[model samples]
Target: MSTDTALQVHSLKQSVDALSEKVDRNHSDLLAAVGKKKKNKDEGDENEERGNWGSKIDFFLSCLGYAVGLGNVWRFPYLCYRNGGGAFFIPYTIMLGLVGIPIFFLELSLGQFTSSGPATCWKFAQLFRGIGLGMVIVSSLVAVYYNMIIGWAFYYLFASFTSKLPWSECGDWSSAYCLDRLPLMENCTMRNWTATVNGTCLNGNGTLMALYNETLSKETMGIKRKLPSEEYLNNVVLGSGFSDGIGDLGPVRWQLVLCLLLAWIFVAATLSKGVKSSGKVVYVTATFPYIVLIILLIRGVLLDGYQKGIEFYITPNLDRLYDARVWKDAAVQIFFSLSASWGGLIALSSYNKFHNDAFRDALLVSLGNCLTSLFAGFVIFSYLGFLSTDLNMPIEDVAEKGPTLTFVVYPFAVTKMPISPLWAILFFIMLVTLGVDSEFVLVETVTTSIMDMFPQTRKYKTFTVVTCCAVFFLLGLTLTTNGGLYMLDLMDTYAGGWNVLVISVCECIAISLVYGVRRFLNDIECMIGRKVCGFIPWVIIKYWWAACWVFITPFAVTCVMVFSWYDYTRLDGYPLWADALGWLMTFVVILGIFIPAIIYLCITPGTCGQKLRILTNPLVEWGPALVKHRRLVARYVPNYVVDPWGKEDQNGIAPSDIAVEMQKQDAPGYTPSPEYYAQKM
Candidate 1:
């Protein structure tokens, strides 16, 4: 009885197993047929559905333009001097290695492999989609204020056409206390006149008041004449727009409004056709600035004070590197200079041809950005050095920072040069060029996010581009008003500064912690090859990318972020509410990121535990853009799981070599034969 029962039970189990296998095979077969049909259909739609950069060079130039922007030409040099001069490079390069290239590579590889924008790419973890949203928001805010600065530059360029640079001497609008020739060194730093009067309120004691008056009377050349350049910026061009406190949003400066209008028009025209127009535009906009920079550099070094200014620029105060603020500045500078967490990098890289070598491009572009900054430092400080000598001032006192460094001080110094107006035109033009080029990428990032989130938007791409421009124009109008400078300060401080740090931190956590760095590395390995030898490995040269993602980047960003919060410096000069408004701009972006997470939890199918798993899971749809990409990925990342989309061998496995073995490998300078274009292209 027992033998018969055992035999019957065993036979029943075998029958069940066979039926189950047949069902599974049928399901796989069904999926295969469906995939084949979709593949055929996608081929027909691929032309319009997928757009790649016209050539690798175009992409490289576009990246160069975006990363080597005003931040490099204007912000970086100032930050270098203001922080610790040559010592700034220690923290800067360290942060660049820790956070810059890793994040840059992360953005580029994410876009190229997925062929998507930041908003849609977060499908890897639905909960992390807010990152893309936050990025877009940050990009949008930056686009607004950033263009405003360009408007200012444009104004200066137009004003430079005067027979003699108006800023060369005091005009009728100059203050009674104005000085035609600004003092050298410490003298110029001392408020020319009014600060001494105002100092009385702070120093009611007769002793302090007498000391201030004695210093001013002796050092101020016995007159309170405004520096002609300062007067020009404060009165002639700006038209006393900053006259009142930031309490009132005053009338729009018509000249600035026109300049802003012109800037927007240029951006709209450039980006209307999307990457095609921007790519071609970058060829000029990106390279022209370097030409001007070089011209100025040559002009600058040949001048009198070049050595002194450059000395101040590169002279290391090693002690300053130990300060937390210096470290924070380095991190923030790297973030802004490289355009990280703004979505622009992701958006720009999204247009690349599938299987493009994004890894090499990332390293090259990131290093190029740093080199460009150092070059810019020389170009800038050389002039400041000359200016310092001209004014009999020390480099520290006369080497202005930020907008003052760019617009007021630089223009003032140029006035002392031969053919001042010509140099002025070139300098302002360079500023405008850098400004407009960077603006292109920022707006493109916003545009790409919208197009991806709602694919239907592509049908009205022209309309959408116009709408974004119009919207940004309207928002930027506030910056065109008298209080616009304050508005720009507020937005720039909030949007691109600390908030970007938070966004960077979140990205590292999302990919490395939530989406899985291993998964991302597999994706990267597919588009670009495995880590190779040479000066190839950055820093330690092995698993450097992975180390950045998991350890270095997050830890570095966190240290800077925590230090920032510890001191929490707000953009000074405004009221408490102005600072509050800036904080609001930051939080609203951060809060928006959580919205997607909430939506994911509600709509995701599964038990609470299952939903949590999905929150932490990578979608199967997330992977290389096509089979070529998958094959490349398979070569290096062993045992990687990918959705082959039914491309399988007889053994029922996606053979590592089957997909790409026959394809020519990418060599030192070797390029893939263009399936749809010239091989080199």
Candidate 2:
């Protein structure tokens, strides 16, 4: 070799050595600064009093309250009746086991591990931070419309305190078409109405028809009728006539606006202190509904035709399984019922003490949610059977969904029993309690996420909660207008429907695929260990959860999205603009996932490959929230995997190789293991 070339090589080696020494010094200083900051932050955390569940029971009830919502009372019974009766449970159970519990366990563990809300928890994979943003938006949209339903319940509960139910005889709200009872038209033949037909019997047009002799005749027997209860709901509760459609949402009903305000006030008061306050509130809001449900069930079973209703609910039609829509409905119901992908579970679990056995909580909450749906089915169908007998109508005619089932049909059914007003009060109170639990929890999710993103706001939790609830209440006022129900329906269909499925697909992929299922399992092991309760296996950390998170969950949720798109039918009677608005809302959420990712890639300072690697890597702060628990975490995953300056990233050291060294502790120099650094922390 040339002498000049050898000198240049020696100079380069010296320069590299000097740079390495400088980097090591800077890293040491950085470590010290981080440690001091952590110490100060820990002291401040104690002074400020971090929000936590008051007890283990507080966490359980809060989760249960959020999971088992109004859907259990209204939606599930109808779906069970519509989709092969008892046969629907087959798809429901399959979806629950494969898709429901796995995702539930994932969210609970993720939140508990990070001690952060949905938005901030994505530090593990920053590229997917948009998922958290999308979750917040979806929850916000739902909160607006959800409060309106609660307002309607409040309106009913207020009306029930009177001696007579307003819907019983339909006072001022009744129209000429309102029929409290069927007419004595035994001799008349029901037929389609025509201008040429003139008779003294009611016509199919819901109006009186006159004959040439002005006497009642069989020719007019085709007249249509509407129930007084239906008129009360349409005119009194909804005032649907004020607005022609979504395009023209008429004047707000002051009464409904007041009721909505009351509901929001209750929610804000409950969440005044964040989860600490909400934790205590859930004890009543969560358990009261069960008491009312059991009471109603006892009352319903004593009714005459309840046996028929139960039979209708449980009578399995195996043929219905052949329909794809049945499976889709089951998947949707299970997803929404457990409140997966909504961020509430994550937010609720985030307040739990670290290592609180979230695995057991997940199992208990999911099981409670499913069981409540089934139990509520018995109560709902039993009442429907009684309604069928009292009205002398078929059980098919008695069943309804959404507002009609709870506010209209159920209220009318209450009027049929002895001491009708007492029963009416109990029913609406149950609705209010059930709805309040869900409403406050949704608000809590939003507030928790906000505080997570801005730690400074944690000290002013009450103000934060009130501000959020007030914003949501103002937004919900539009739904209290005459055409609000139409708007509510549109939002419900578009905001929370397919977008949620898409988000679920993204979440499953992000945590299991991009983050590496094996690494995630190791983290789970670090937190909860192999067995819970000394005997029950944490099966979710086993092969079953691995398969579901990696393959089954993503695939199942994708199929649901595809089927929903295939079955997409435009809402009848809605304007094209309204449909476009719905789609626009949906796209906004979908873009929430993509736009931030593009921005992240553009701003990151590195080669495309380096940027991708950094984006996929877990943050240094991604381990257990408490430093104490990270020792076990370090035993499993190398500290360098999270530390940017660690040789794992710079020297192309494989995680497996580092794992071996962590166990052997035979490294040449100072090794940055958790035990070594945690002491500094």
TM-score of each: 0.81, 0.84
Which runs in model 2 stand beyond 4 Å of their true positions? 1-49, 181-184, 189-224, 539-541, 640-681
- Local distance difference test, each candidate: 0.78, 0.81
Best by lDDT: 2
Misplaced by over 4 Å in model 1 are 1-47, 181-225, 240-242, 531-542, 627-681
Candidate 1, residue 26: lDDT: 47
Error of 2 at 77 (Å): 0.8
* Model 2 TM-score on a 0 to 1 scale: 0.84
> Candidate 2's C-alpha lDDT?
0.81
Over the stretch 391-433, how does candidate 1's per-residue lDDT look in tens digits?
6655776766677788878898888888999999999999998
The residue-by-residue lDDT of candidate 2 on 1-681, one tens digit each, is 899999999987876676566558645755565456556544433212355676789889989999988999999999999999999999999999988999999999888877888888998889999998888888888899998998998898888898887888747667755655434332345544333344444567756543322222333554444567788888888888556889888988999999999999999998897777888888888999999999999999999999999999999999999999999999999888998998888888887766678778888899899999999999999989988887676787679888878877788888887898899888888888898888877888889889888989988988999999999999999999889989999998888888888888989999999999888877776667778655677664477788999999999999988999999999999999999999998988889877889999999989999999999888877765544455567776755334333434445332322232222333223355535533433
RMSD of each: 12.9, 12.4
lDDT score for residue 184 of model 1: 22
Worst 10 residues of 1 by lDDT: 201-210
